[model samples]
Target: MKFLFPIFALCALLSSCQALAGSQAGTEAKFAPETITAFAKNVEKYAAAQGAGAFIIGRIGRPQQELPKGIRFTHTAIAVYSAITLKDGSTVNGYAIHNLYQETGKPDVSALVVDYPVDFFWGVHELSAGIIIPTPELQQRIIAAISSGKNKAVHNPAYSVIASPYNNELQNCTEHTLNIINASIYQTTDMRQLKANARAHFKGQRVRSSRFKLMLGSLFMDDVTTRDHDGKVVTTTFSTIGRYLQQNGLVKHMAVFNRDGSSGELL
Candidate 1:
C-alpha cells in the first residue's frame, strides 16, 4: 500500500506539470489577427460616433499647419461616405491613411515609412478619436516589415484638410492634446517626476540636452532646443542622452526648463 501511494503521488506530480505546460503553450499560441482587427474596428466605430474620421498626419519637425493639402480631407472626399459596421450594430465612417512616401513621378513603388495615427480632423481631439482599422491584410504587412527589421523611409507628403471651427481651440490646448495622444501612442511614462529631476539637474548649469530630446525623445532630438533661464544654450546628445531618455520612457512633448531657484517647469 505504501508503494502504491508513492506511485500515485508521482502520477499526480507529472499530471500537474503537464497541465501547466499546456496552459503556457496555449498562451503562447494566442496571438490572433482577428483580435487586432476587432480592436481596430471598435476604434473606428468610436471615432465615427464622435463626429470625426480616422486618419492623422504630421511630420516630426514641421509645424502641423504645414501638412499638405492633398492629404487633407474635404466634404466631397469619397472616404467620408464609406462606412464600416461594428459588432455592436453600429457603423463607423472613415478611411485608413497609410504613411507612404509619394513618389514624385513614378507611381508604382512608393516605400512605406513610419506608420502614424491618421485622424479625420486637424486637431488632436479629432485625431485621438480617429480609428485606424488594422485589417488582417494590413497586420500581415506590418508583421512582414517587423520580421525584416528594416527602417522603411516614407517620402510621401503628408495630406490634410482645413481645420473646422468646431476643433479650433487655444493653441495651448491643441499642444496639450497633441502631447497626450503622442505619449499614449508611444507608451511614454508619466513625466511629472522625470521633468522634475531634469530641471533640478540642469538648472543654472550648462548641460547637454536638446529641447526636442527633452520633450519627444532622441527620434526628433536634432530638431528641438531651448534657452535656459540664464540665457545659456542647452543641446541634447542624440546618440547617448536621447536614446537613454527614450528607453526609459521619460521623453515627453512638454518643455523642461529651469524654473525660479531649483524647480523644473513643464510648459
Candidate 2:
C-alpha cells in the first residue's frame, strides 16, 4: 500500500524500470513438445492412481530473480480428478487444474483460471514435477470448495512474485494456493481467518536481501517496498505450502515425476 516512487525515480535516473521488468520476465517455461507430452501422460497416471478425486500438484519450473535462494519448485496448482457433466449431458473426466494466472500486458495483475494437464505443463521450463495426493476425506472437501468458486475468493489479484506468508495485501502463485488450501480445510475464506490460519500452518524461511537488492526491488516492483518487506524477504513459496500440508496430515503421499521415465517419493 505504500509507494516509493520518489526513490524509484531517483534510481530510474540511474537505471530503467522497464529493463528491470524485462530482465525478470522469466515466468514462462520452454520445454520441448515431446517432453510436454510425456509429462502430461505421467501426471495423468498419478492422478488416476488417486482413484477419481482431487489433489494438489506442485511443479518445478522456471525461476525468477525475485525468488529467494534454495527454492526449487516455483508453482503449485489444484488438480481435480473427477468426472464432470456438461449441459449437453456429456461427461468429461480428467485432471482439471486450477491456479492463478498472471495476464499478459497487465504487469502485476492476475486471476484464477483452469488449465488441463497438457495445457498446465505447456511452457513449463522444467520436466520434473511434484504430485501431492491428499487423503480421501480431504480430497472431497477440497474438490467441493474449488468447484463452488469459494477457493478463488481468497486470491488477491495484486500479484507479487515474492509475496509474504503473513499478509493478504498482495499474493504470489504459491501464496494464493496456500490460502485457498487453508480456507478449504478450515471452512472459511475470511481475510482475518486466512491470516490466522497461515500464521499457524505455514512454515518456511525467507532470505533477507542485501541493501543493494532491496534498493533494486523498491525501484522496480511496486509491491516490494521497504516498509512491506522490511528487508525485501520472501517466505511464501512452494516448499512452505508442501511442508504445511505434510505436517497437517492432509497429504497421503508425495511423488516426484521425472522426464526420464521415473518417479519416486520426494524425501
Candidate 3:
C-alpha cells in the first residue's frame, strides 16, 4: 500500500511533539496510565478475535483536545500477532496489539499522534494459493492453543508470510545480485578508484539486457558481466546497463565521468 505520505507526516508530527515536550518542563505528558492499560487490553481482544498471538510492543499517548466532560486523546501503538503449530500436529492462532497515545501541543491545544499498528495475525483454514501454508494438523493445533488462551504451540517452519509488496519485489529479483562497492567514492577526487569500485561490484551479476543503456549516465557507468550457472565468470566491461539500486539510508550524490577519464561534479 502507498503509505509514504501518511507515515512521513506522522513521523514529522511525532518528532515535533517530542521537541515541544523537551523544551518545556512538565509542560506535557503522555496519556494516563489507566487509559493506556485499557487500550492494551482492547488490543489483546482485537488480536484474539483475529486468531493472533497478541503482544504489545510499544505505545505513546498524548492529550489532544479537552472537552468539558473528558479529554480528547491521540495515541499510537505497535503489536505483534502470530500463529503457531506444535510438533504433535496441532495449530494455534495468536495476536498481540499495543496501543500508545500522546498529547500534541500544550494541555488543551490541537494535538496529533501517529499510531504504528503492526499485526502479525494469520489463520490456518484461510490459506491462499502460492502463499505460505502450514500443514493441516499444525493449523488445528494453533487454533486449539489460541482458543484456550495459551501460546505454547510451535509454528510451522515453512510458514513464511509476505510482509509487504516491497518484500515481494525484492524476492522476485533472484537473478541479479546488487551491491554497493564504495559509498565514499562519490566524495573522492579519484576517478580511477571509483571506476574500479563500480567494476568490482557490478561484475558477474545477471542483469536484464534492456537495463544497459539506462545504467550509463554522465557521472557514473555500470559494468555488466555475464557468467554461467556453474559460477564461472565469462565477460565483463563498462556497459550502459540500466539498473537502479534503491536503498533506504544512503547518502546519494551525482558525479560526472569525463570522456578524458576525469571526475567532476562531486555533489
What TM-score against the true fold does each predicted structure earn? 0.22, 0.80, 0.19
- Tens digit per residue, CA lDDT, model 2, 1-267: 247876665564323222222212235548776768777987788668756387777665544343345565666778887675667999987788888766676657777777777777776656777787777877888888888888778888886666677788777677777777877788998988888777766775574455565566666566343343544465565566666778888888777778875888764
Q: lDDT of all predictions, in order shown?
A: 0.27, 0.67, 0.24
Segments in model 2 whose C-alpha atoms lie over 4 Å from true places:
1-29, 63-67, 84-91, 221-227, 230-232
| Model 2 TM-score, all chains together | 0.80
Off by over 4 Å in 3: 1-29, 54-78, 81-267
Clashing pairs in 2: 29-123, 29-125
lDDT of 3 by residue, 172-243 (tens): 011110111122213332434434554554332232222222222101211111111223222211111111
lDDT of 2 at 98: 80
Over 1-267, each residue of candidate 1 has an lDDT whose tens digit, in order, gives: 778985675554333222111100001212244443443344444434434332222211112243222211111100122455658999864544333332333222233333212321222211112122222332333333333432121111221111111111111111222222223333343444323443443221133333333333212222111321233432211112223333445443211111111212221
Arrange candidates, best TM-score first: 2, 1, 3
Model 1 has how many clashing residue pairs? 17
Per-residue lDDT value at 204 in model 1: 18
Better of 2 and 3 by TM-score: 2
